[model samples]
Target: MGGEKMLRIVMFPWLAFGHLIPYLHLSNKLAEKGHKITLLLPNKARLQLEPLNFHPSLITFHSITVPPLETLTLPPGTETTADISLNQHGELSISMDRTRPEVESILSTQKPDLVFYDMAHWIPDIASKLGIKSVSYNSVCAISMSHVRPSVLPKAAATSQVALSSSSYVGSVPQWSRNDHNSSVYFGDEITLLERSIISLSSADAIAIRTCREIEGVYCDRVAATFNKPVLVTSHALPDLELQLSPLETRWADWLARFGPRSVIFCCLGSQHVLDAAQLQELALGLEMTGLPFLMAVKPPVGYASLKELLPEGYNDRVSGRGVVHGGWVQQQQILAHPSLGCFVTHCGSSSMWEGLVSETQLVLLPQLPDQTLNAKLMADELKVGVKVERQQNGWVSKQGLCEAINRVMDEDSDISHVVRKNHAKYTSMLISPDFITGYIDNFIKDLQALIS
Candidate 1:
C-alpha cells in the first residue's frame, strides 16, 4: 500500500456514439481523480470526440485502425440512426478483430493499474489475459444488465417470483420481468457481449455502473449478487457546462420561451433510435393537437423529406415559433437544465433519462428496442416518473394516442407530471457525485498497489 501512487486507467468504447458518450464522461471523472486515462476508439469515433478537447495531460485518445471489410449495404434511404438490425454490420468484425494487437500494445506499454471497458467487442478477455484488472461499464440501467444474464424470465403465472425472475425478454436467457412483454426481446449481439463480459469480469476486480443506487438500488444489488462481484453505482451528475443563453438563436429561444415557466415539451428520441415517417407524423400531429409549446429534436428518418412534410396539417405553421425541430444533436444537458423545460419526451436511454430525472423535468416515454423498453418500464411503473406510449404490431404510434399521452402529461389535471417532476428532483439530489466515483477508483488502485509493492 505504501507504493500506491498515481493510477493509470484505460477505456475502450464500442463504435457507436451512445456507447462512447458515457464512457468518455466516466474517463473525465476518473481523470479528475489524478489517474492517467487512455481512451481507445475506432478512427471515426476518435474524430467525433476530438471537438470535446478534454484535459490533455490527464487524458488522451488513441485510434484503432479498422481492417478493411465489406461495406454494410444498408437499405436505400435508411438513416444511420434508424432501428437497424444489430447484425447489420457483421462485416465490421474484421476491423474489431484487427484492433486487438494495438490495444494489447497500449496495455503492455501503459501497464495501467486498471482497465475500464465498454460492453464493446469483448476486449475484456484481452485485458484479463494481460493480467490487467478490468470492469464492464454499460450505459444502460441495471434492469438491462439483469436481462443480459444467461437465464430466461420466470413463468407468467409465477407472480410472486416475478421480481426475482431472471428470464430473458427475447431469448432463452433467464431474467426478471416488469411487464407481460418481458420475454425474449433484446439485442442478441449485445447479450452475447454482455454475457462474455460477465464471465470475463468474474475474477477481474470490480463492476461500476453509471447509475445511482437510489434509482436502481434493488436491481443493482441483485446484479452484484448474481455476478458475485463488487458493484459501484455512480450517478450521472456531470459538471455544469458553462453556457450562456442567447436570444439571437431565435429558434431555440422562442420555442423554449413558449413553455414559459413550465409549459414547453422537449422531445428527443436519442441518437440511435429515429422514428420512421409514420411515427414522425403521428408525433407531430400529437404535439400540434396538444397546443403545448414544444421543441422536438427530430433526427429526420431515412426516407423522410423535411420535418414539415412529416407533420399533420398546420403543425409546421402553428408550432414554428412555439416549437423548434432540430435535425441533429443539441447540447442535451443544457436543454434539460433550462428553466423553461417543463416536460421531456424521450426514448428512455438510461443516460438521457437520468439527466432529465435529475433536472426535475417530467418525462414521456417512447422507447424503442433493446434495453430501452426495460428502462422505460422502470421509469413509468416502478419509479412512477414517466408515461409510456403504447404501440401497434407494425410499431406505429397512433396520432390520436400520441396527442392524448402528451396532453395527459402536460395537463395540470393529471398528477403524473407533478409526481414525475418531484421524483426526478429527489433522484437528482441523491445521485452519487464525480468525487464519490473517484473515491472508488482510489480504492481500486490501492488493491493494485499492494501487488506491485
Candidate 2:
C-alpha cells in the first residue's frame, strides 16, 4: 500500500433504483478515496444518478445496452429476480445468459483490481476467472440475510415472532400476522435464495452490509459465518446535497409552513408499491377522516386505472390547496427534513426509515412487502421511535384502521406524540453520522491497499 495509489473498480447492479442508488453512494465514496470506478447499468437507471451529475469528478457511468430477456415477463417498473419467484432454476440461467457477456467484456477491457456486484447477479465467477477480487452488496437488512439461509428459515420464523413482544416494546421484531403468507411461500424460496446466495458468497472475496453492527449485530454474525468472509457493516452513506425546491415544490413548502412545528403528517409509499383502485379510495377516505393537514405522494401502477374513479366524492376538492398528491418522484429526503413534518406514515423501506430517522420525523410504519416488515419491526419494536398501524379486517389493514392510527399519531393531547418525538431525537443521536460513514470508506480503502501491497 502506498500513498496516492489508485485502484480500478467496476460495479454491476441489477436494474432497480434501490440497488443502483446505494452502489452509486459506494462508488462516490470509493472515488473520494482515489479509486477509479466504472459503473455498468441500464440507460433507464441513468436518470436516478442525474441528481448526482455534479459529482463527475469521482465516478463514471458506463451504460451496458443488452437486449431485454425474452423469458420471465416483468411487471412494469418491477426489475430484478426478487420481485418474483422462480419455479425452477431456469430463471437464473436466462439472466446469466443475458448479462455474462457484457460483464466479461467490461472486465476484459477494464482489468479492474476489484469488482462489486449485487447478490442476485452470478458474475462472481467471471471476476474470479479474470483473477480479480470482488465483493457482494446487499440492499436489505441483516435480518433479511438471516432468513436467506434455509436452515435458518424455521428458526427465523420462530425467532422473529418471539423476538418482539408488541409495538409497545423496544428491540423486538413486530409480529405480522399477515406474514403467514411469507412464511408459507418462504419454505421453498428460502432454499432457492440460499443456494444462490451461497454460490455468490463463496465466490466473492468479501461482503459488505448496508447496515451497522450496533443495530443488527446478531444477524451480522450469522451472515458473516454463513458466507465465510469478513463482513463489513457500514451505515447508509448518502451524499450531502445542497437541496433546493422548485417553484412548484416551494408552494408545497408554503402550505407546509401553515402548520405549526411538528403538526403536519407526511405519507409516502416508496416508488415500487402501488395501490389498487379499492385501496386508493380506501386510503383517500381514511386520510380525510383524520382531519389532518397531510402531504401524500401517490404513484399508483399503470394498470390501476380505477384509482381516480374510486376516490371518494369531493375528497380532493375538500382538501384542495391543503395537501399535495404528487403522482411522480418527489425529493423524499428534503420533505422528511422539513420542520413542519411532525409525523411520517411510511411503507417502512430501510432507506425511508433511515431518512425519517435522520430527519427526526416521528415514524408511523406501514410495511407493505419484502424486507419492509422487518424494518418496521426494528423501528416500532426495537427502536421505539415509531409505531405500526394496527391490523384489522382479517389482517388486511383496512382504511378505517389506517385512519385511526393516523388520528392517534396526530393527536396533540396523547403521550404517544411526546414519546415518539423524544425517541426520534434519541435515534438520530445513536445512529452514526454521515462523516463517520465517509471515514469507514477511507479505512476500507486503506485495508484494500494493504492487501495490494
Candidate 3:
C-alpha cells in the first residue's frame, strides 16, 4: 500500500431503485476506504438516497435532470423506471441514453480517475475519450450475467411472437440449445436493456458484481472468462442501516407476534412487476388455501383502485384473522427479520434473494422475469435453499402450484424443507461472518488500485 494515491471515483447507476441502491452502498463502502466518490443520478432518483447517511467528506451526490417526459412519451415527472409502468421501460431507457451530455459535463469538471457505470453503453466510450478508466458494475448476479453473454444467447427467429406475459418470454430465463450450450433469446423491450448490458460489459475496462463467490463461484468464474475482463465481487451487499419499523410495521409486528415461531409467510413481489387480475386471484386463493398467517404487500394492476378491488370476492372475510393484504410498500427487511416469518414468496430479484438468505427465511420463488427465473434456478437447483413453484408449459403458475410450493417449504418434516433450512442456516452464517465482507472489500479495493496503478 506504500505510495498509493487515494482515487476519485464517479458512480453512475441505471435509473432504477434496485440499481441505484447498490451503487450507493458501494459508494459508501469506497468512501469508508478513504476514496472520494461522486454519485450521478437523476434529480428525483437522488431523493430516494437522501435518507441514507454516508461519509459526507468523501461522497458527493450529483443530480442530473432526466430528459423531458413529453419527448419520451412518458408520464410527467417520470425520472425512474418505477415511476412508469413496465411496458414503458424501453422509453425510460431511451431517456437514460440522452443523459450522456450531462454525464460528460460532470466528468469534464470532476476529472475523476475512474468511473463506474451501470448498463448505459455510452458511458464507457465517454470515459475512454476523456482518458479516464471505466468499470461496468452489474447489479444483477453473475449467474444471470453469465447466462446472457452474447455467445451464450440464442438467435431470435423471424416468426418469434411477442411473449403474452413476461413469464412466457423464452430468453428471459436460461435455456439450453440443441448443441448443449446455455442460451436465451430476448424479444421486444427486453432486447434494449439486454443490448445495453452487453455493450457496457464489452466496453468496460473491468466488471464488478454485487455477489459473492460462495453462492455463485462457478458462475463468477464463467462470467470472467466469457467477458474476458477482471470480474470483482463486492461481496453480498446488505442494508447499511438496521430497519426502523414504521407504524404500519408495528401493527404488522403485533399481528405476527400471535403466530407460532416460523409460521407466517411474507409475500411481496419486488416493486416493478404487477400481476394481472387472473394471476392475482389465483395467488389470493392459493394463499387462502394455505391457512397460514401471511402478510402480502401488493400493487394492484391498472384499473384496480385498491387491493380490495383486485382481490377475489369474500377473500378478505375468509382470511381476515390470518392474512393481511397491505397495498403499496412495506418494510421488507424488517418483516423478513421477524421470528414469525417462516417463508418468503419472492420474485427472486438479487436484493430479495440476499435479504431472504440473510434472514434465513425459506424461499418460495415465483419468478416473473428472466433474470429472476435464473435467480430462482440458482436458489432451487444449485443452492438448494429454495423451491420454484411449478409452472405450466406456458409458464403459468396455477393456484395449486402456488399452494404446493408454500406447503413444501413450510413442511418441517419434508426433505426439501429440511434441506432448505439447513442451507439457509449455512449461508446465513457465512454471509454474516465478521471477516466475510471485510476480506472481500479489502481484496476488491486492492485489485482496483493495482489495475489503475
> Highest lDDT among the candidates is held by which one?
3
TM-score of each: 0.80, 0.82, 0.89
**Model 3, 1-453: lDDT tens per residue?**
346688899988888888898888777777777889998888777776776536778888898888864744688888987887776766777677678788889998888889998767668777877878888898888888886565433333211121122222233323421111223333223453455555677678888899999888898899888767899889875654354223336677799899999889889988778888888888888888898998888788877888888788888999989998877877787888888889899999888888888886788998887788889999999988889999999777898999999999899899988999898899998997758887888888887887687
lDDT of 1 by residue, 294-342 (tens): 7788777767656765666766777776767667667676777678887
Worst 10 residues of 2 by lDDT: 161-170
Per-candidate Cα lDDT values, in order, are 0.63, 0.65, 0.78
Q: What is candidate 2's CA lDDT for residue 85?
A: 30
Candidate 1 clashes: the total is 21
The best candidate in terms of TM-score: 3
Better of 1 and 3 by TM-score: 3
Give me candidate 3's TM-score against the actual structure: 0.89
TM-score of 2: 0.82
- Which residue ranges in model 1 land beyond 4 Å of their true spot? 1-4, 51-53, 71-94, 151-204, 243-251, 392-395, 432-453
On TM-score, the stronger of 1 and 2 is 2
